[model samples]
Target chain A: MTKAVSSQPKTKRGIERRAKILAAAEQVIGEKGFAAASIADITRAADTASGTFYIYFSGKDVLFRELVEDMGRATRSQAAERIATAANRLEAERAGLEAYLIVVRDRPMQYRIVEEARFVDPDAYRTYYSEFGKAYADQLQQAAERGEISAGDAEVRAWALMGIAKTLGERFVLWEEGEVDIERVVAEAHQFICNGLAP
Target chain B: MTKAVSSQPKTKRGIERRAKILAAAEQVIGEKGFAAASIADITRAADTASGTFYIYFSGKDVLFRELVEDMGRATRSQAAERIATAANRLEAERAGLEAYLIVVRDRPMQYRIVEEARFVDPDAYRTYYSEFGKAYADQLQQAAERGEISAGDAEVRAWALMGIAKTLGERFVLWEEGEVDIERVVAEAHQFICNGLAP
Candidate 1:
């Protein structure tokens, strides 16, 4: 697809203004949806003039694509930091899952927006997951070779682990009505991840 | 959420007609997404007059909700049929995951529609997964009591398993570029389900 991020802010003030617009867009689009959410609404939420949006993003589609990419970058950075300190691949998996759920809890709007990308921006959505899946598979493969985790189809295992993390984040964090206990979720899920459903 | 599916077709001919409209609507909405797809587009796909659409459902919202429900029912029935013969919960999980991927392969459009429901009809989407998650946890709890599998937190395990099947279906069945080997996916994932990442 054509690069939707048409411009990049060069100065600190410009960067801050762009970040404000993106944050506003995430909340507006998350609540109202991609189709119903308007650029004016996003700008209004950002407390900026509507014309100012063009200085950062070329259009709504451009801005939406940026949000999808942003979720990937943000989640990866967060997960990577925690994963770095893990003792092994199994430990890394636990850390990564926890990091993912924490991100979902903090910036719930971003989570919703990324899910919306499946419809609004199909290519971006595919790239977001597949790219993450590829990188995740690479890590799992290296782990298996290092004898830190069981040897199996790393790609399949990676997607499965990613799935487990994604759904838990949705059910326990995003859609939860009462107080969330993410620690309990991580502990229980980590048990299953480390030791299957065997009796 | 105001009960968009207004009426149920009574006569056989009416049932047939309504079925035609729904099948067409699934295709149209899957291709163009929920908001961009219009009643006219659905009717044209059905090879019927635009007004004929109103006979079955109230509006696009109702039809979209029905499509989301349809995926859940179809998947559950298919899975139940397979799971009934499985010797234990682990076997049942394998059967269920296989059934899910097969459905994704066969009715890809329906899969897209249900995913779209996350944004198009949030309540229905929540109900769809939560209901399934609850029932799945029930089965896991029962199996745990029977000494068929090790269990820690049934609810957390249920959502995590659902996540694995959902993502695997998306990547292997829905988004695959080459010939689909669903049997391999089922086998590989079932291995992980019965035995996690431990070496």
Candidate 2:
């Protein structure tokens, strides 16, 4: 939330222009990466004057951090809405994984950009996952108290579950051009999540 | 394995020089990232002439790919040795997770470099994980057949288990300066892996 530059746009036109620039930045930065992509490149893609970028973001670093934050917000909101529909914690896990894969398939660029944040803006990258992990762990703790899930290390389980969704999304959705069978993957993974691999 | 420029060195001295350059490149590229790191920087760090790098690597991209491959080899060998001692697949799972965390702790730079390969060299990045995933799935299938673990989708479970180990390594080992207590993390994770979250 560091306004490195550019105050919030007051006018409708200004807001629309800013949004357009961000959308274009996502495409440009996502393709060319943070280092090779320049402000000129972003503005050109946005079809706005080069000066317009400075009006919205201080520089490339600020824009990159903002993109990471933006992706985090979008992903969390999507997961929240999907998880709300589930009957219990177990169902919520399936819902959340399905929602995450769908997001990765639809917005693959944003996913890549968020990962790139690990190098470009380490602080933002750490904060993005740390905050999500904290909230996720809290939810697991509450579910355990309700006997929705077997009691265990909520923090450890939270990270382990997140790992499952993230890796699956990368392997099955992002890597494949074919239609991803997310439902099947979810069903199988859900079984493992519910029951340990014990004989 | 794409020799975009140079071939393998013939003599022992030549091989040592190549190894030195690769090691230096790992330090530089891992620290400054691929785009920011320069040939001169790598050569200087290796204490070799700039011309000598061309004798070992064709360019930065080739060196980066080689580094990715090297990490894969190193990690796989480590996991194989540790897993060989396990009494069964369940024990192997715990041993493998512990070994992975130890590798991350010891070679944090190599881990970062491999991740960076997703952007710098997509083919290498995909190949690294795809090969590992295939082997992991095979082992899971064998274990399930032998009744060492519950039967499930081997591919799905492989990725899930890998995700757990990877995310845990990043969170509990790489990010922390304090003693990571690897044994405790492995024990808690092993329980969840064995019994899952269901009561």
Candidate 3:
């Protein structure tokens, strides 16, 4: 029997190069708005051939949208798993915010892309955000059903909570580049929403 | 000798033309994404000559930024006037939300411009949103100081409240086509935020 040679490279180095291209594209899109970034600039930054980029992404918009969807899904997945194990409402709420913060802080480029997607493509925004939002809303509904929280329309309150948490994350926690303790910020926000400012 | 005709007509008309151009620009940019919009489109929509647009704006970017600023200022003015006249914490919250809804409903063009600005220009976004945000924050702060609400951080709570109100306005109340009772939406939002789910 004759041995057959495979055309594809099986080396780990090829995979690393593809990741490098995505990372470079993320950075370029972050610095200059995504609409302004060109493939040539991305390829140059990635230190790869123009042909190599096509191996990873069909185009910039595809890459941008995928980066956004991945980050949002990853954040939600981590939250869902943790929330599933939480003992109470407070713990679940805390876990949810913390999960959001982790994704946003770790992958800020992804957050920016998701935020930008709101204006760029409303359908993508609805699909990406609404799915994650519905999951969180389901959690909140469960808490209300269990009588752990005040009873009213859970969906509206869930939407309101999501809005509040997202605004705070964008403002004080995720966007801050200075030396600041994130733990305290998250704690304050979680408490304020879960229990509120009332005594 | 004939009295020298004042050069002021040119300047006065220029200001009017600039305002007209900006008003038209907001609609065009909002309906068509900024990247897709052109000078010809804006000028034609505004009913002003193409040359008149150049006299006021260097390009679409200049016109868009100014439109955003003007919208921000108008929204803030409504907020400021409401806060200045409010009787109490709950009433102030109501007034503030009403102000936001009225501005958003009356000037859908401005709302679109603000939405676009959030995606494209961070500086303009901050300049526009934070100002209105702070105005709302100040109302909450005063309410807390007067013992109308809890003594927790008013600024943080205010932002949270604003986030909810704005989200509801954007996602449900304002964007939805057809007969949207702005008054009812504002009332429900105010009740939810100020009184919580406790009935």
Q: Report the lDDT of model 1 for residue A116.
A: 87
When sorted by TM-score, best at the front, the candidate numbers are: 1, 2, 3
**Residue-wise lDDT of candidate 1 within B21-97, one digit each (tens)?**
99998899998988889999999999999998888888888889899999999899999999999999989999999
Model 3 chain A worst lDDT run, 10 consecutive residues: A1-10
Model 3 over residues A52-116: C-alpha lDDT tens digits? 87766766777777767777777878788878988887677778877777766777777777777
Candidate of highest DockQ: 1
Fnat per predicted structure, each in turn: 0.93, 0.81, 0.27
User: lDDT tens digits, residues B30-149, model 3?
Assistant: 888788889999999999888877666666776677778887688778877987887777777778778877788788777777777876666898777677667767766776787876
- Clashes in model 2: which pairs? none
Candidate 1 per-residue lDDT, tens place, A1-199, comes to: 5555568889998898899999999999988888899999999999999999998887899899988998888888998999889999888888888999999999999899988888878899999999999999999999899999888998999899989999999999998888998888999999999999998
Please report the TM-score between candidate 2 and the true structure. 0.94
Cα lDDT tens digits for candidate 2, B1-199? 7548757888999999999999999899989999889999999999999999988777998889888888878777888999998999999998888888888888888889989998888888898999999999999999999999999999999999989988998899988668888888899899999998886
Pick by lDDT: which candidate is best? 1
Candidate 1's TM-score:
0.96
TM-score of chain A of 3: 0.83
